[model samples]
Target chain A: MTDRLPHPLRSDALDNRERILDAARALFATEGLNVPMREIARHAGVGPATLYRRFPTKQMLATEAFADEMRACHVLVEEGLAEPDPWRGFCLVIEKTCELHARSRGFTEAFMSTFPEAMDFAAERAYALRSIAELANRAKDAGHLRPDFVLDDLILMLMANRGIHTISKTARVAASRRFAALVIQAFRASPQHSPLPPVARLSPAAPGKVM
Target chain B: MTDRLPHPLRSDALDNRERILDAARALFATEGLNVPMREIARHAGVGPATLYRRFPTKQMLATEAFADEMRACHVLVEEGLAEPDPWRGFCLVIEKTCELHARSRGFTEAFMSTFPEAMDFAAERAYALRSIAELANRAKDAGHLRPDFVLDDLILMLMANRGIHTISKTARVAASRRFAALVIQAFRASPQHSPLPPVARLSPAAPGKVM
Candidate 1:
């Protein structure tokens, strides 16, 4: 078939597309969505015309860049749902989600920001929230989750988790782990005396300190 | 005695200084510390020369702008220290501090950012930490706070609280209150199920929805 033909031009176009995406993801992850298109093109070693030809708008580039993370986010929700124990599943989802966000500042911003044009992104977010809400109801029925817990509480937790910043990605994740433990404890139906994860060295007093 | 003399020029300079500080505080609270010097002057109804004469640099302006908040912060710590119950004291400090920071985004940024020339700010911060550490120790001794609770956990909570964004100052404060309650529950040595403050409507799903 023509579609399966080994065409040199098509292969090169595919390679350029991949390179541009890679650069966009890296820059956005580090410097956030404000990084200019020209900088992304330079980083990808592609011409301005080629970059524009592939992704005409910054929003398009951002939506494409975060596509993988969004998919991973859905998989996380699925994994939680697959768990037999609803409470444990909920905790797992919170822990994993916080860690995922901690690894990429850009993803957190994108997830929280209202992008009117990104319908798919919004729909995916709504789907994930619904799944979590269902899981929460199960946990509440089992009397393992706090009765007062609301779906908006999860949003509050995510927003709070987004505030964590450290000198290194590793440290941010560590801090997030401890934070997740605290949050899980708060959300539990009963106060279980569990040892928290080790503290991450996020003190601003000791500037330049890494975890 | 000469300092008390009511010279017209001195009174006018004092009025200008007050206006500049007020404008700086308002702008910094809403827009952050990045607002330009000329803009601040314009907001204060002062000339560029007068603003520069009053505050030679942005750092100096920021320092002066936040002086009142710094004092208020110290008062909060002192009030907490004076409370009979160490746990209650700790919780009060957390709740009030978070509310204070929530009202002003710029103050949070300034508190977290290290300014080399702002020695007073650093010293006050260190003092506040030491006082909180002393309070935590008391709480631990009294068997009220979790044994594993560290000073850094407070920092973690503050950073997380800083992440909350709402449509209005009232909503932000409400969200911070709820977040503080959650953190307090997490920090408690015993799991006592108390009702949380009413949840603030901070969901991004319903964009433009105010609390």
Candidate 2:
């Protein structure tokens, strides 16, 4: 496997590809996906000709850039899980999720605009969430969390806090942290803490007219 | 106020309007909203002229149908709240929501296709949810439920559980019940029960991809 590794030429090409993606992420973050290919190439320290030779299309470059950000998120969660304390581990994981969501909000909105159903990305997401949920459950069973908590509810609720990204950066972090801590407290194994009020029933607006 | 009650003629007209809406709901459920005005009038035991007078246009008719169903859901939750147990009340409310969702799925899809956002509907929905959440919180405070729970989490998770609908009705109900119980257990202020797995992260797919 070592002997079959890329020679100097292939290694140089690989480095250029990485650089292009880096440049695309920065550009996409700043100027967005429609930014000129020439600009991206310039930012990457490569000529437009070299950029096309690598990605062949702007969509390819943008996709790669977006995927790189997602890959970084996966790495962040992995690192979070490496923490010795499961409570700390889970907190770090959720916090990392909020950070990534803030950065990729534009990408997410854009992606879903074209794919209305969102099932394509939903597949991979479902798998990852299920895995993490299992881990959270294990921690709960081990007495790290309150027993009545389920991972599925927390995941959707946290992600559904889409309002968090719209907040100011400093406030965003504070809000995200508050949201995480609140959910965590709700997961406690004991009823030492107070819960929120119960939900009310919706009234029918002249409901007798249910045609 | 009693002396100022509507004249008999006005009362008769109001009854006719309600009759028309009922016919519209049935027709929309069976044949959908594209059905001719004559057909709806026929179903309502009135003439096309009457439906037009009551509804004004197709959009108004559709909105009325949608609002009618939502109002019915509101009633179900309200009635459920009178139940002796808070858990039962929550379950009853969710069950009604699922039933309404099953019926309104087509109507909502058609409506949203023409108008991308339903800000009014969403706001009303959030308002209704806030009420339900408050009730759940009350139950928790009363030591009737686990302390670690969020109402938004439960609602979102239920919405996400579309798969359960594909199964047999009995099975679907059972699954929903179990799902609710699991959430309730997770919210239980105890250490013996286990927390559910981690929340699922949605995959932000590339646009133009649904599956």
Candidate 3:
């Protein structure tokens, strides 16, 4: 009964809990989801026993630690839903969601890998997808989004976005932003309004007319 | 001197060599590049020493085995170059190249990973990219391809296409075809011509103005 207390703790226990979470958040953000728990405890200045006593499982800790980010996701989706223009709303959801994923490697991996025990997180993801679907339909009806866009295309974009390899985290985010813009442009039921840069190839060939 | 013979062997040795290559091709095609050389030797009904004698390194084996496919690639690029219409040629190169990659997981990985000692393979890739780049410039000059399309976009597509997870290779190929078409359309200079399928979202949402 005591093991599953929502918040049964003295002052020091509560402090220890906060330190552990802080360490976890820092490590997970910088190093990704695979950071060892013992290392996290060491960083937190807490013993392994103390860390284990507070958070029974890694999944539990991930769920709790990422709760804020999840809430941020919910907020972003809601904001998208609230937009008056459905197409803009759809784009907002995509751009923001991708940016969110790009910023945190751990969260990105977690979201895709499916923490089976994290029912709430799963449910939240499902709900978010449903909302985005509705937004897509609205955008299509508004004639802003192409009629033929499939939901999997978004997943396709995300999976592709995940593959963007750059030198630094900032470079990744910058590249992601550009990728998101390109995706948005691709999705728009419109013509090319702006000129692109010079074409480069992955294979050997005669150099094209480079202007 | 024997090691440097390069096909100076007798009839049975040549037969054994062919069998070894056949085995390597089958295994590499189905199981990716990670399959053990011993397994390949066993499959070929040859002693491991025989296998080692023929091809001292995995890179050499891979380089020789994939030479045909690489030749096909060069032929495809040449065919595109032969076309009077540069834009059509560029699109053909992309579509065909993507299909080729999608069909063979091993080739896809090998091409991207760049095995050390496979200098010839790397040179071919560089040559192909150069040809594609020339095609791109001609296409843009022809007013068919967008001016801003970069060579890296092809890399982006390949990287993204690699992420398409599906139950069957056939399905993955199909999805890849659709994805290629989308990318091609996105790269085209003109406005959206054809209607798309319904938008698919990764997250859940209410049915917004579904038509």
Candidate 4:
């Protein structure tokens, strides 16, 4: 198949496609998935036609842009499962994955939004949840996790973490870490635990206000 | 003031104003604060002119619409503070206040969103927080609440509760109650508390999908 194409032309097309994907990822991370396609083309230094030739729609771009995050989430869950201490591993996945989500507005929305076109990503999410559920069971058996905790409790934590709004990315990451720690404490079978992370001052924002 | 007004005209005008307020409260409670002014007028069986004469702007209407909710919240906090058992009082505030917020979307937004014209509402909110803070101190001294708990955690809980989205209002209320219970459990000084309320199944929703 490669021999059927002109080498230089094929290589240039591939390079442009890579540039488009890279630009989409960067823009989506900071500005969310709503960034315009034309802007993405300009950021990639590619013509609109060239960009559209590689990716036909915004959904296609989003599906491709978020593939890496889904993989990273999968890797995080797997690493937690591999750990000898089930409870520590469970906490690791929650803390690190939430931090990852906090860093990217687009990935956070994509992870939580329903998209029929993103079946592969959805499968990856389900796999992660299943692995975490197993880890939760192991942690409970170790007498570290509260026996009454349910899978939905983790879901509840994520939903709560999703509400955190801040003035800056650093503040958001800080807030998420503190929230994750609180959740971990809540999930602990015993009351003994380390001191919580410092309070992340929550500035007034939409939907949730400190006032 | 009554003597200064014209006789029959004054009574009719007062009646219209009360009708408009009643309609706004009902609509805002159900459809949120964004219900159209004309729609509110129609719902109240009055003309647009009457609605406009009473409330020149949406913010004024919102301020009027949520005054009751603010009062209710203030009353709930005061009731909690008056409870003899400080820890139980603290739990009561968390459970009932979240239930109140969950019951009305307009009031929820009004509670969180900053409003310069709503100084009275803001003062009420501050008063509630102050009383709750005192109650929290009492809970800590009672040795039921974890000493590490902070006022910001209550803010965090409210914020998280705001993120809950469901297919119906009933589902939202159920989720909020369950979340409040989990939080209270987490905040408890000992693991000797009674079993948690059952999980209110989380429906799939945007910005926080459940697998």
Candidate 2 docks with a DockQ of 0.04
lDDT score, candidate 2, position A155: 40
Query: Model 4: runs farther than 4 Å from truth?
Result: A1-56, A116-119, A190-211, B1-54, B116-120, B190-211
Q: Give per-residue lDDT, candidate 1, residue A26.
A: 94
Return the TM-score for candidate 3, rounded to 2 decimals: 0.73
Which of the numbered candidates is closest to the native, going by highest lDDT? Answer: 1
TM-score of the A chain in model 1: 0.82
Query: What tens-digit string does per-residue lDDT give for candidate 1 at B1-211?
Result: 1123454357889899889999999998877676788889999999999999878878778878888899999999999999999988998999899889988977877775455444357677778889999999999999988787877777778778877743356666777877787788788886443332222222111111110
Rank by lDDT, descending?
A: 1, 4, 3, 2
Error of 2 at A59 (Å): 5.2
Task: Note the chain A TM-score of all models in turn.
Answer: 0.82, 0.56, 0.83, 0.80
User: Candidates' TM-scores?
Assistant: 0.83, 0.46, 0.73, 0.74
Residue A7 in candidate 3, Cα distance off native in Å: 7.6
- lDDT values for all models: 0.76, 0.54, 0.70, 0.72
Q: Write the per-residue lDDT of candidate 1 for residues A132-191, one digit (tens) a residue.
A: 999999999999887777777788788788777433566677778888888886788765
Model 4 per-residue lDDT tens digits across residues B69-167: 887898899899999999989989998998898788777656654453443556776788799999999999999897777776776677667665422
Best by TM-score: 1
Estimate the lDDT of model 3: 0.70
* Pairs that clash in candidate 1: none
Report how far residue B87 has shifted in candidate 1, in Å.
0.7
Output DockQ, candidate 3: 0.11
Report how far off residue A178 is in candidate 2 (Å).
5.6
Against the true two-chain complex, what DockQ does each candidate achieve? Answer: 0.22, 0.04, 0.11, 0.15
